[model samples]
Target chain A: MVEKKGLSYWLSHAGLILGVIVIGFPIWLAFVASTVTQSEIVSPPMPLLPGGEFITNYKEALFSGINAPVALMLLNSTIMALGIALGKIFISLLSAFAIVYFRFPGRQLFFWMIFLTLMLPIEVRIVPSYGVVAQFGMLNSYSGLIFPLIASATATFLFRQFFLTIPNELTEAARVDGAGPVRFFFDIILPMSKTNIAALFVILFIYGWNQFLWPLLITTDPSMNTIVMGIKQMFPSGDDNANWPVIMATSLLAMVPPVLIVIFMQKFFVRGLIESEK
Target chain B: MRRTVIFKGWKLPILLLLPQLTITALFFFYPAGQAIWESLFIPDPFGLKSQFVGTGNFEFLLSDRYYRNSFRTTAVFSISVTFLSMGIALYLAVLADRLIKGAGIYSSLLIWPYAVAPAIAGVLWLFMFNTRVGVVSWYIGLLGYDWNHVLNQGEAMGLVVLASSWGRISYNFLFFLAGLQAIPKSVIEAAAIDGAKFWRRFRTIVIPLLSPITFFLLVVNIVYAFFETFGVIHTITSGGPQQATTTLVYKVFSDGFVGQDLGSSAAQSVILLFVVGLLTVIQFKFIERKVHY
Candidate 1:
C-alpha cells in the first residue's frame, strides 16, 4: 500500500476525530451534570465543566436515591449480571458438549428445540412469560431476573461452533488413555475451552448487565431494581422535577463496570461478538 | 457439524442436557404456547369466566387503527435506526480504514459506547435534549425553534430514533471496520493501479466485498430496532405525544401490563412471533449465501 502523508491523511484523521467527539459528547455532558447542582442543570445552558458537588451528588445517589438507594441497585445489577453470565455459560457448555459429542435418540430434536429459543426473545412474549414467572413464585427474586433471559441459544450455539472445531483425535486420544467421557471433559475439554469461555463471558456479562425490560417487569420492589431500570424510577411522575445530578451520577455508575470490561477485555469482546453473531 | 468421535452413554448426555431443556420447556415453550392459546380467545372484563372467541383477538388487532399504526411506526423506526446507525458507522469505518496509524485509539473510543445500555443511552440523550434545562434543546430554542418532544410528535420520534441509534453505532462500526480490514489490500492496490481514485475504488471494489457484512448488519440491526429499542422508547418517550412513537414491542407492554388487555397483548405477541420467525429465516438464508462469498 502506498503511504500518503499529505492532505488525505490529515483529512482522515480530521474525520475520525470529529466522529469521536460527536460520539463522546453525550457522556461528557452526563459527567458534567453529575458533578453539578440540580439547579445548574435545570436552568438553561448547564455548565460544560465539572463542578464541586461531585462527592455530594454521588453520595446522595448511593446512600439514598428517590425510589431505592443507588447502592442497592448497583448491587442488584452486579448479582444479576454475574448470575446470568455464569449460568448461561455453564448450561450452554454442558448442552453444547452433550449435543456435539453424543449420538443418542432425540438428540437432533433437543438441538432444534434449543435452537428455536433464538426466535422467541422475551420482548415478544412478555405477557405469558410474566404469568409463567408469577406462577412459579419467582417474581422479585434473582432467579426470576436471570432464568427467563438465559433460555436463549446464542451461547449454546457459540460453544457448539467452537466444540465442532476441536479435532476428533483429541477425543480418541482421551479414550485411549482410559479416560471416561466425564473425566475427559473435565481434564481436557474445559481446559481447552478457556479462551472461548472468557470471550463469551465478556460478551455475556455486558448483555446481562445491560438488560432492561425483563428486570423492569419482574422486580416490582425498589430494592430489587437494577440500576438501569431504577434510573427511570427516579424521574418525577408529573415532570419538571427530575433529580438530575444524582440521576446522572447513578447513570455513570451504571455504565462503569460494563464499559470497563469492554475496554480492558476488548480483544475477547470483539472476538466473542463476531463469533456469537456468526 | 457434529464431531465424529462421540460419547456413548445416552443417560449422561440426557443428564447434562436436563437443565437447559427444563428451562427452555418451562420458560420458552410453555409461555409461547400459552401466548398462542390465549391469542385465540377474548377474556371478558371479569377474570372469573372467559368466553372463547376463536381468532377474535387477532381479528380485532389486525383491524384496530392503533395496531395498524403501530406496525407502521415499528417499520419506520426500525428502518430509520438501521440505516442511520449503519450509515454513520460505515462512514467512520471508511475513515478509520484509510488511516495508516492511530486507528486503534479511535476504535477504542468509539467501541465503548456499545456497552452503554439502550436505556441509559435514552436517558443521556433525553438529558441533553430536555426542554427546560437540556443544553441542546436550549440551543435549539435560541435558534428560534421550540424543541419540545413532549408535545411535538415528530420531534419525539426523532429523539427516540437518535437515542436508539447512538449506542448501536459502535456495534456496527466494529463490524464495518473488521469487514474493511478483511478486504485484501492487494485487491484495493490493484484497483488503484488501474487508475481508480479513492471514491471510485471504494465504489467498485470495497462496497461489493463488504456486502455480506452489510447484509448481516442490516438483519441484526432490524432485529435490534424491533425488539431491543423497547428500553429506548420506554425511557425517552414512553411511546408518547399521542402514540407517535409507540412501536410493536412497546404496544405489547403497554397493552398487556398497563392496560391489562391480556387477550389483545397475547395476539400481538403471536404476531411478533411470526415477524421474528420471518426475520430469523431471512438471516439464515442470507448467511447461507454469505458462505459462498
Candidate 2:
C-alpha cells in the first residue's frame, strides 16, 4: 500500500518468493535425497522429487547408523538440550533475582565475573576447557556435556535486563507484606518471569541442540554423541561411498526439533534473540 | 547495575550467585587462565614435562608460513561469509517489508535454516557439492567445469563459505526485518512525497537509518565466522586439501586435538581470546548507542 499499483510491488513479491525457494532448495534436496535409495544418490543427478525408500532409509538410520544408532544420539541430544536450557534458565533466574533484588558485598564483582564469560565462547578456549573437564574426570559424562556449556552470560544478562524493568513498587509491596526475600522471589518474581523464561527456554534449547565442537570433544563414545554431532560420524570413514540416503535422513532428524521450535515459537524466539543481544 | 529497592541479606545473595559463579570459575575463568599459562609452556613428546617457553610458541606461529596463511584464509573467509549472508538477508528483508501479507509465511519458510546446526548445514551443502554424487556438481560439470572441492583448494574454501553464509542468512534476515520494520514509515513517506524513487529512498533513507543494525551485524557476523564455524569447516574441509580452509578456530581444534600440540594451540587460543574480546567491546559499544535511540 505504500506504493499502489506499481510493478515494483510485484517484483518485490517475486524476489521474496525466489529468496524463499533459494533458501529452502538445499534442505528440500537433502530431504529428497533422504527419501531416495543409496544407489540412486550415488549414481549422480539424483531425482529431485520424493522416492519410495523414505521409510526404510529412516528406519535403518534410526535403528542402526554408521557408528551408533540415530535413536540413541537423539536421546543424548534431548538430554543435552533440556539440560542446557533448564540449567541456564534456572541459574540465570537466580543470579538475576539476586542482582536485581539484593544488595550485597561482591555483587558487582560477581556481575563482572559473569560478564567476562560473554567474550569467552567455547571455541576460543577449547583446549583448556577440555583440560579442565578431563581433569575433573567428567569427560564422557552428561555433566561434562552440559555443565561447561551452562555458564551462559547472555542468559544471565537477558534475565537481568528483564528483571530491571520490573516495577520497584512490586518489590516494596512484597517487603511490606512481611515477605522475606525468598518468599517475595517465589511468589512474585518467578510468576512474573514466565514469558521470559519460556522465550529463553526456546532460544537456549536451540542453542544447546546445535552445539557441535564441545559435544564432539567431550563425548568420545559414539553412543554418547548428540545427533547434531552424530551426523558427522555417519559420514564414510575415507573416500568410500557415504551412505547418503541414511546420512541425509539423520541430517533431517538432527534438524527437526530445533527447526520446529523456531518455526512454532517464532514470536518467542525472535523476542528472545533480540533481547538477549541487548 | 544495582537496584535501589533491594533485599538486604548478603548470605542469600551469595548463595543465589554460587552456581553461576562456580561454573564460571571452573569452566570459564580457570580454563581461560590455563590457556594463558599453558601458552608459555611446551610439552615434551613423551608427556613427561612441559618446558617453559617465553613467547616461543607465539614466535613460532607468527613465523610459520601455514599459520600466517591461516590468518589470510580467515580474513577472506569471514569477510565473504559476512557480507554475502548480510547482503542476501537485507535484500530479502526489504522485499518482505514491502509485502502486506504472506510476510509471515515467507519468514517461516526461510528462517528454519537458522535452527539447523552449522555442521548439518555443512553436510547439506557438502552433499550438493559432492563431486561424485552431487546434483549441483553435476550441473556445474555440464557447464564445462570440473567442480571438485576435494582436490581444489579454492573450491573447498568457496564451498565452506557458501555453507556458513547460507545458515546465517536467516539470522541476519530476522534482525534486518526487525530493523526494517522499525524504520519510521513517516520518513519514507516524506521521501516519497519529495519524488525520491524506491531505490533512491532505500539507498539513502533506509540504509542510513539501518546502519546501526548493519554495524551490529557486521561485528556479530565476524565473530560468528571467526569462532562459530568450526563445525562447517570441520565437516566439510577439515582444514583442506592443502590447509587452505584453516581458520584460526579450526587450526586450534586440529592442532590441539589432532596434533596434540598444547603449547601452540593454547597460544592460538589466547590470540583468539583477544579477538573475541575486541569484538565483544565493539558489540557492546554499538548496543550502548542503540539504547540511546
Candidate 3:
C-alpha cells in the first residue's frame, strides 16, 4: 500500500499495457484477417488493421461456407449451448433438491451415483459413451448431442452445497403453512435460488457453448455441425487452400455470444465460478 | 454433507431424482462400466468378434512406444502449459494489483478470453503462426528463424502449448488477481516499514500467503492441460508432425476413433479415469482446505 508515485507506478502501468497487447494480439489479428481478402491473409504480413471487406467476408461465411453455412452452425451452437445449460441446470436442481431435502431409502446411494459422475468427464469416456448413444440411435440427433453431455457433477454439487446452506427453518415454516414438499420447493427454494441459478447459468452457458470434441465426434453430419466444431471443418483438406477470411469470420462469430455473456454478466459469472469451486 | 432437514419421502424424492439417476446410469455409469469391460477385451477393428485379454491392453499400452511417448508428451505439455499460463497470469495480476486505478479495466480486457473455446484459440494462434501465410511466422522469419510447425516437432508442440495457454491465461489471471487482492495490505505495509523492498516483501509475505491458491490452480491447470487441450491440439496439429503434440486425450481419440483400436483406447480411457479420479479427490480436499485457509 505504499504510495510511491515515481518510476514503479509508471512501470506497472506499462507492464499491464504490454500484457494486454500481448494477450489481445492474436484475436486482433484474426479480426483483421476476417475483414481482409484471402490474398492479404495468404501473403506474408497481412495488414494489421481492419479492411473494407468486413461485410463481404462475414456475409460469405454466414450465408454460404465451405461445407455447411456458418449461419446454420451458429444456430446449431445456440441450440446446443442453450440445451446443455438449461438441461444441466434443470436436472441438477431437481436432483440437488431431492438429495438435500429428502431422507429416503437409496437416497445416499443415488447421491453417490451423481457424485461419481463428477470424475468421468466426456473426454475420458467418449468412445464407449459414443457407442452407447449410437446403440440408442441417438447419434447425430440433438438428444445425442445434448443428453450425453448433460450429466454434470459440478452443477449438482454446487446446487447441493447451496441447498445445504438454506435454513431448515424455512422448510418448517412452509410445513406450518400446510405446504407439501413439492409446493414448498416451487414456492420457496426455486425463488431463493435465483442468484445461484443465474450464476450457474452464466458458467454453464459458456461451458456448453465452448464444447468442441464431443460435438466433433457425435455430429458426423455436416448439417448438424455446431459452430465450434464446424470451424475445424472450414480448413480445406490436403494441399487445397484454406479460406482464411471466411474461417476468421466464422471464428469471430463463434466467440461473440459467449464473450458477450462473460462481459455483460461478469459479476454473476464470477460468483458462479467461485461458488461452484467451493 | 447431510442436511438436518424435515422432508421424508420415498416416492416423491425418488421420483424427483429419477431423471438424473436415469441419465447418469445411461450416460455416465453404463458407458464407464462398458469402458472398463471393453478394456479387458480386444475387439477386432471390424467389430465382429472379440477375444478376452485381461490386462493385455494395459500391458501393451505401457510397453507400446506411441503410448509411452504420449504419456511423456502429455506430461511435458501439461507442465509447460500449467506453468507458462500461470506464470504470465501471475505477472499480469501482480502488475494490475500495483495499480489502484484501471486494474478493473485490465481485468475486464484480460478475462474475456476465458469465453473463447480452446479450438478457436488454436485456430487463431495457428493462423498467426501458419508458416506460409502467418504474420508472426513472417516476422520471425525476418528475425532469421524458420518457424514451420508443419515439419518441426518441437515447433508443433510449442504452438499447441501456446494456443492452450493463451485461452487459459484469463482463467488463471482472474483467480490470481482475486487471490492477490485478498492479501491484507497491513502485512505488506508492516514489511515495508521493516525495510523490506517490494520484491523481498512479495517473496516472503505475498507468496507464502498465495501458496494455497497457487496449489489449487496447479491442480486445476494440470487437469485442464491433460484433458481440455484436446481441441487445441486437434485444430493446430491433429497430433502433428509425427504425433509430437498428441497428449494423452488426443491419443485416446486418435486410437479409438481414428485407428478404431477399441480395446487399447478403452484401456487409455481407464487410465485417464484414474488420473481424473485422483485429481478430483485432490481438488475436493484442496477446495475444502481452500475454504478453510
Candidate with the greatest DockQ versus the true structure: 1
Query: Model 3's DockQ?
Result: 0.80
Candidate 1's C-alpha runs over 4 A off are: none
Question: Each candidate's interface RMSD, rounded to one decimal?
Answer: 1.0, 1.2, 1.2
Instruction: Using lDDT as the measure, name the better of candidate 1 and candidate 3.
Output: 1
- Model 2 Cα lDDT, one tens digit per residue, B112-198: 898999999999999999889999999999999999899999999999999999999999999999899999998999989999988
Query: RMSD (Cα, Å) of candidate 3?
Result: 1.3
Candidate 2 i-RMS = 1.2
C-alpha TM-scores of all predictions: 0.99, 0.98, 0.98
Ranking by DockQ: 1, 2, 3
Model 2 residue B99 CA deviation (Å) reads: 1.3
- Per-residue CA lDDT of model 1 for A136-242, tens digit only, reads 99999999999998989999998998888888788778888888888988988899999999999999999899999999999999999999999988899885679
* Stretch of 10 with least lDDT, candidate 2 chain A: A1-10
Candidate 2 clashing pairs?
Answer: none
Write down the worst ten-residue block by lDDT for model 3 chain A: A167-176
TM-score, candidate 1, is: 0.99
By DockQ thresholds, what CAPRI class is model 1? high
Quantify all predictions' global Cα lDDT against the true fold: 0.93, 0.91, 0.91
Docking class of 3: medium
